[model samples]
Target: KWTWSAVFTLQWLGLSIAWLDGAEVLYTYYYPTHIVLVGVTVSLIWRYYGR
Candidate 1:
């Protein structure tokens, strides 16, 4: 849905900006990023199959 897509896109853009700003070591963002990724995946699956 739009909410999930927006969350994913915003997170991706934030990460990309951070990396471009010389934040080569993004160790702190791994857990949050994984959480967002999993959330998006689960949201898609539930939307389609949990009907």
Candidate 2:
């Protein structure tokens, strides 16, 4: 439920940005900054929960 709420919040933020600027939805690089953020989040979860 919490992850669903987080996804909803991210969607709302993305939509707000896209509404303000059509270019906000565009991904300009093969290696985007958000990918790094995702990697860090995954690594943290793995560090805490991995066997």
Candidate 3:
């Protein structure tokens, strides 16, 4: 869980830095990756804590 949290945090941080650095071209690619990560994170949390 912490591993995923760290990954999610780092992913956002990298995305923010890239956007601030004028890397808009990467946004298209990052969007889908971000969505998938979010989905996985949510499912993992539900599966772990929904007991």
Best by lDDT: 3
Highest-scoring model, TM-score: 3
lDDT, residue 26, model 1: 53
Task: Give the least accurate 10-residue stretch of model 3, judged by summed lDDT.
Answer: 21-30
In model 3, state the lDDT of residue 33.
80
How many clashing pairs in candidate 1? 0
Q: Residue 16, candidate 2: how far off, in angstroms?
A: 3.8
Worst 10 residues of 1 by lDDT: 22-31
Task: Tell how far residue 46 is off in model 2, in angstroms.
Answer: 0.6
lDDT, residue 40, model 3: 87
lDDT of each: 0.72, 0.58, 0.77
Ranking by TM-score: 3, 2, 1
1-51 in candidate 3: lDDT tens per residue? Answer: 687779779788869876876757457667778788788888988998899
